[model samples]
Every structure is written in C-alpha cells, then in structure tokens.
Target: MQNNLPTRKIIHVDMDAFYASVAQMDNPELKGKAIAVGGAGARGVISAASYEARMFGVRSAMSGRLAIKLCPELIFVKTNFERYKEISKQIRNIFLDYTDLVEPLSLDEAYLDVTVNKIGMPSATLLAQTIRTRIYNEVGLTASAGISINKFIAKIASDYNKPNGQKTVNPEDVLQFLEELDIKKFYGVGKVTAEKMYQRGIFTGKDLKLKSLDYLNEHFGKSGYFYYQVVRGIHNSEVKPNRIRKSLAAERTFSENLSSEIFMLEKLEQIAEEVSKRLNKNKVAGKTITLKIKYSDFTLQTRSKTIPYFVSEKAIILETAKDLLYQDTLSNSVRLLGISLSNLNTDSKNTKTEEKKVINVQLKFEF
Candidate 1:
C-alpha cells in the first residue's frame, strides 16, 4: 500500500523554547538561567518555560503559582508577542527560499512541503540541515527539524531529537517505526483516549493495527478510521499554504464563577469586544455569533445564531451573544465566557454586492 502512494518529502520545523529562547537571546544575563514567559500573578498561566525550568518540572499551561512552587528561582518574564512575530517572519522567509509550500502551525512551528523546492535540492535531509543552520546563524535561535514522506511521520520524528537537532525517517522504516511507538505518543490522542485504548488492550501501534476497521469504528466513531490509517503510516493531509481563517474568537477564564446575569453580561461584552477587534483586524466579518459558557463543574455549553448579513461590530456581537445567553436558562454558575464569529466572508471585495453563499458552520469549544 505504501509503495502505491505518491512519495512526497515533508519537513516539520519547530523552534526550541520559542518564547524563553527569545528572552535569553535578547538578554545575555538570562542565557543560562531558568526563565518563563507569562503572567506572574495568582491567576496567571505560564505560556512558555526554558529548558532550565523544564528540568525542575515547570511546564507551559501550568499555573504561575504552581510553577513558582516547582522552581522557587523561576524568573517570570512578560510575553513579547511583537518580537516573536518579527523573529518568526525571518524564519518563514528562510523556508520560502526553499519552498513556497509552507504551512505555519503557529509563530514558532511550521510544516514545509519541499518535494518541489525552489532551491533545486534533491535530498530532504540536506535541505533540512541547510534550513536549520541558516536559522541558527541568522536568527540566533535553534530549531528541531523532522524529515519524512508524510506530515504525520515528519511531525513525530521532529520531536525525537529536542533543542537543536534533526531526525529523518526513511520511507522503508515507516512501518517498523510506527509499530514500536506507544499509542499514547500518537498525535491527537489525548490522555482520556489513551486510557480508553489501554483498557481495550491497545497499548502500542502494533496493538492498534491488530484491531479490525469495523471494530475500531464501533468503539471510537469517525476517529476510528483515522487511527486505522495513521497506525499504518498513512496520513494524506497536505501542507496547505495560505489557508483562510475559518473563525475569529476570544475567551477568558474567570478567577471565580458568577451566577449573576449582570456579571455574565459584562464579561460577555468584554469578550465580544476582543472578537470584534480580531475580526476587524483580519478584514473579515461573519454572520454567525457563538456564545460559549463553561460551568464551575467543567460542564460546557454553546449557543449560536446566524444573522442575515455579516457583522463585525462589537455592539452587534454583544447583542447577539446576550440574546443567545438569555434564550437558555442558567445551567450553572459560569466559570468561563467566550465569543466567536464564524461563517466569515473571505472575499475581499464588498460582500454586499456579492451573492451570499450559505455555509454550515458549527461551534466547537475546548476546555
């Protein structure tokens, strides 16, 4: 089956400790120290931690208070998104010099399809090496690269070597490499899913390969078929460059849950303002407005409404969100509030003159 498919060279490049590394590079004093980028307040979350901090068990998304507890000498630095964006652009330009097929996952990581590169490089391994070396010399930062025939294998191989290194997975070794991998290490397999798979005696890729497609579908729904193919090293998802924005959203988790409708309204207004700003900045507007609510018990609910025309104004977003909120009775005190705009008008011209196409948009929230 693998021999029948078209072979393509894919490379995944990920920056090492992106935010923390930038801080260390800018300030010579912080070069060898344990540093973190995020808020230091009681309710703050760590965005990124340096390798030194990681040694002490500090991690991103962990509470600032908990991070401090883990590493008493942890230095908290405020996030500098502007500087990160500037550095990210420099790295992206380097990728563009090789291939136009560059898909940025975030400011610090990207997947490049170098099967037909501008540099006329035949070997993906050497291309990756050149890219990494150029980035280190020009950007003063280290990046890890993974070279493989597909995105799935490439992304996984990139992490095999951390900090400043690169790894290549030849097409011939794809099957054996996957079979020896732990099921939990597969991308998109969360802790809960891993636990479920373990209970079903599926601990490794080899164990997963033994299950029939029908049996997996019966137990895991649509994702079952996805697992079936990925376990055999079959991931056809392409590295899509210039992907359009599907939605714009903003969310905030409160320090305390609120039961009062008035307080909820205030929070929703603030979130709506953020969504409106992002929509305007992107020069896009959506007809759909979604309101997401999370209760103290972790129960989540979303209410959405699609209007006749695209709207990006904060007043309209807040009004629509408030209407959705009032339609459903309060389930429980809200711990988080979010507002999102979807069904966006991607056309740059005046949308009022264009024929409106109805799109089925669904709201999905992650806690």
Candidate 2:
C-alpha cells in the first residue's frame, strides 16, 4: 500500500449551463432566457439547454420537438465548433498557468489537481476560487468550482453553489455532509437506480454505506464499487488532461508536387478513415477537429473546428474534413496533410447531485 498520502488539492470547475451560457455571452437577446444549442429542425436533438429551459423540462438528448414543448419560447442555434474550441484552448491555457494537472472534462468544465500548484497557494479551495474568478474576469464567462480532498467530493461541492459560485469541503465535513444526502444525489444514480435504492430503503449516504460490496455490485454493476467508496467521501481517481486524441491520422507527402483537387480529397479520405477507425475502437468522441496541411513551398496551414459536442463517428468527421479542405483554394500542390481531434470528454460526468462521484477523464494533446 502506498503509505504517503500527499495532501491533494483537488478542484472541480463546472460551467453554469455551459453551452447555453456561451450562447448568452455572445447574444444579449438570449440573456436570462431559455436557449438551447443543437438541432432546431425536425429530427434534431438538443445538445444543451439553458437553466431557464431546464426549469421547463428541457434536457440534453431530448428531441427538438420535445424541448419546444418543454419551453415554447426556447431559442435554438446551430453548434459553432470552431469558436468553442478556441475558447477551450484559451481557458485551458489559464489552467496551465497554475498547474499541469489540469484535466478538462469538456469545453466548459474540468477537474484541477492543484495539490502542488504554481501559485504556491496553501489551500486548494483558494486555488479553485481564484481559477473561477479568473475564468469570469478573463474569459467573460462564469464558472462554479468545487474543492475537496478528492475528485469525488470536489465535484459534488462545485455544484453546491452553482452558476457563478463555489464551495469547499474539507476532510472534517465529509461525513456530516454525506450522511443525509439523498441517494439520488450519488453519481451514476439515475431515476431508475435511485428508485431501486429507495425501494430498498436506502435514502442517505449512511444508508448506502450499510450495503455490502456484493449487494451494490449486484445491483449497480461496475459503478457499484465506486458508489461504495463515494458514500464515505473517498475517491482516488487522478486528474488527467483531455489532450489525447482518440484517433491518429497520418498523411503521405508527395515527393513531386501534385496540383489537383481530386488528389487532396483522396489524401484527406485516407487520413479521415484512419482517424474514424481509431475513434470507433476507442468508443470516444472529439469536439474539436484540426486539419494540418503543408504545401510544396514548405508553407503550412492549420484549420480546426470544435463541434458543438463530441463525435467519434467516421462519416461525420469525413464530411467535416471534406468541407474544410474544399474551403482552402489549394493554390499550391498539397505536400502533407494531418488531422487531429481535441476538446475530448471521454468520461463526461453526468450532472452532479450532492454526494456522488462524477467521473470525467481528459487525454493530453501537445500540438
């Protein structure tokens, strides 16, 4: 067993109605109103809904028609992947200023392991608050941060005072805070699971604490093991940056310059296929896609777009790539082409309750 328990300074940063908030930040008309980003036409699904829309029952994955029913006055906008990626990169750079242990959950949220920080602050809570303030003052955005001994509790506390606020949970308050927590508040406990636990008379963290590992496993599968530890306010997961692209694409360079639109399309197709296959295997989606191309003249241009949400599918990426490639006039014969994905949220922690372990993983990308 590892005897050295480093005093970890973990902070969970959650954006308030992230997607909707972004929409509002740009358009004053959408302020204090119900707005959603995603499909607005028939067969469209809501990628995100504002808190106002949420009050009327709008939610992610819900069909456009249903979301409209939930909020009749809801406004819908198409996803702007490119702009969001740039913002994500900018905010991530801010985190890097403090520590390399920044793990981005998505374009809007993250878990920061500032146990050993760049600011040299003694308390993780202060770091979290500082980060939140910076995000607001610097980025023209508001974020809620949670601070705790571990990722599990820190995530929960962040949601405590959401929408431009933050809170801290020291080791001393873990037990009391979790004891009376509703079972539904635990991470991964959706309506069905919460109902099941309720039927079994499991209402609070203390009640869940009484369940044997076997019992929780039988009922909740792999997540059961996590739930067991979470009720005790323990989570040992590490913070990892979302830098790794699920797909790797390599482009071939022509020894002799080739000047043809067909040639560029074909090359992009090959690279896109390779990326698509990798994405399928990993079962992950990327919100940002970057295309790097080199000309025979030794000139390089990089075009990138951050999708409204993550997409791991091959067809969508190829389509997007084709559009981007076409947008380039292709004055010089293409010598090299490369593609990469970023703003990846592999473990998108579901919306938090009060005392649950929200799991989100970030892969590292240095380019």
Candidate 3:
C-alpha cells in the first residue's frame, strides 16, 4: 500500500451542455427552454441537449424525431461552429494566462497542468475557482473543473460537482478516492467494458485492484494492465498540448432519404467542398479520401481510396467521392453522406517513455 509517484497538479475543465448552451446564449428567446442544437427534421440528430431537455429523457445523438417524441416542446436550433470556436478561443486564452500546458480535449473541454504555473500559485483549488469565475464574467459561460495529482483522477473528479463547480483531490487522498470509485466511473471504462468487469465481479476500483496484473491482462487484453495500474493510482500520462490530429471530416444528413446515386451526387459535392475548405484552413492535406454512407436503416459503410499524392481541393475531393459512391451497388437508401481525409501531412515525433520517479507522498503535499 506504500509507494511513491511524482505528483503533478492537473485540472480538467468541462463546459456544461456547450453547443446547446451556446445556442441559448446567442438567442434570448431560446433561454429556459428545452433546446437541442441540430436539425429539427426526421433525419436530423441532436448534437447537444440543454439541461431542461435532459429532464424529459432527451440526450445528445438522439434522433430529432425521437427527441420531439420525448419532449413535445423541444426547440431545435441550428449549430453555429464559428460562434462556438470563437468562445472556445476566448476560454483557451484565459487558460494561457496561468499556464502554457493547456491540452484541449475538444472545443468545450481541456486539461491544464499547473504544477508549476506562471503565477506560482500553490493552491490548485483557488486557481480553478478563479478560472471558472473569469469564464462566467468575461465569456458568459459556466465551466466545471476537477483538480488532482494526475489526469485520470482529475477528469473523473471534474464531473462530481458539474455545471459550474469544482472538486479537488489532495495527494494524500488519491489512493482512497480511487479505491472507492465505481468501475464504471473509471476514465476509460465504457458501458461494454463495465458489463464485462461486472461479469468478473469487478464492481469497484478496490475490486479491480485485487486482481493480479497477469490475470487482468489475460482477461481484458492490453487494457487490463491499464485498469490494474490506474486503480492503484499509478497513471503517469502527461497532458499533451500538441495532440496530433488523426483526421478531418465534414458530413450532412438529408431531410429525405435518397434512393439513387444520381440523387446523392449533389449532396456529396457539397460535403466534399466543406471537407476541402476545412483542410485548407488547417493548412494540411491528406493522401486518403473516405466516403461515409449512412443508410435509412442506420447501418454505416465506408469506402476509401489512397492516392499517390495528397490533395486539398474541392474538385479533387468531389471527384474521388463520386468515384466511391458508384464503386458498389446501392445496398439501401442513404440518409447521411460524409467525406473525410486522413494520413495528414503532420510531423509525428516519438516521445521516449520515461521511467516513473516514484517517491513517497509527503503527508502535506499540494494537489
């Protein structure tokens, strides 16, 4: 039960219902209503749902028709990516004021390493509060935060008191806090994994800790070792500021399902243009082009072509997607079409793994 590990102050900040909240913030008329940000058609999917919508069992990714059935008065607002990005940049600037080690998980959430900050602040708790207050005052958004010794615990703690709240787990309490955590609450554990763990009687972190490393690996494959290490408070992953972009994509859902390739050609063209524009904005091109098709029955199929040369042009993208669309016979009527490019032109550096410098946690160390 006694071991040493380097303690780093990590804070996870998460925005509450970001897309839906932004929609509500921009439109005074949408305030205090059950709002969902996405299309309001039968084929439309909810990108985000306001807290009011959650009360009626509506959630993000639910079909618009299903959401309306759940909440009869649900309001659907179109997504505004430009507005969201603007606000997100503002929030990221606020983070840069304290520390340069900011790793954005998405436009709405990020991880900040403040073990050694610009302000030389000793209290992560106070720093988290100050950041949240500034967000509400300056950008007019509420954010929740979790402060802990590492990213794994910090991320889970942030959700404990959500919607403009913060939680701090001191170094001395890390072991006990993690041991008592539910297996499902572990950072990387999903519904399917949780069910698998339950079948093995691993209901909590403490239960998971009892299994031998060999036994865990034998059962869960590579992730079994991750579970064993994290439950014992041994996670050492850093908050990477320059996380590599794996892919860039754009997609659209049709109001009515199209049954023929001729009907889908124009939609594919528009989607390819969007993809090309995004690639140009990022100043990156890819050698691989993928065409995604979602049928009326909700099954998905992808066709990809890897060219000898990277491309970032609307004409090239459209032509490639058109070729893929007609590559095979129609399986079913298509409802959604998407285009994506991968194998981006970006540097990939191999970070050498550093052995953990374990030292016993002093009784009075900062988070």
Best by TM-score: 1
TM-score of 3: 0.88
Candidate 2 lDDT over residue span 1-367, tens digit each: 1122223668888888777788888898889898899958765678898888888999987878888887889999878878788878878888899999888877888888876779777777677778878888988888888887777778878888977898887766777778877878766688998899899889989899999999999988998888887787666777876445444455555544668878777777788888878777776668778888778776899888777877877677877887788776876877678877766665334224346354432322110
Q: Model 3: which ten-residue window has the lowest total lDDT?
A: 347-356
Q: Which sections of candidate 2 miss by over 4 Å?
A: 1-7, 242-367
Using lDDT as the measure, name the better of candidate 1 and candidate 2.
1
The clash count for each model shown is 0, 10, 1
Better-scoring candidate (lDDT), 2 or 3: 3
Preferred candidate (TM-score higher): 1 or 3 = 1
Where in model 1 is the C-alpha error above 4 Å? 255-257, 295-301, 329-335, 347-367
lDDT per residue as tens, model 1, 1-367: 3555556789999999999999999998999999989948886789999999999999998888899999999999999999999999999999999999999999999999888789777789999999999999999999999998789889988998998999998877889888999998898799999999999999999999999999899999999999999998888777879776788899998887899999999898899999989999989999888889989787889999999999999999999999999997988888788998888897444245645442222212110
Q: For model 3, how does the per-residue alpha-carbon lDDT over 1-367 read when each residue is reduced to its tens digit?
A: 2446757889999999999988888888988899999848877888999999999999988999999999999999998999999999999999999999999999999999988789988889899999999999998889999999889999999999977899998877888998899999998999999999999999988999999999999999999889888898888888888887878999988888999788799889889889999999999888899999999999999999999887999999999999999899879999899999988776352234456444433444455
List of clashing residue pairs for candidate 3: 4-359
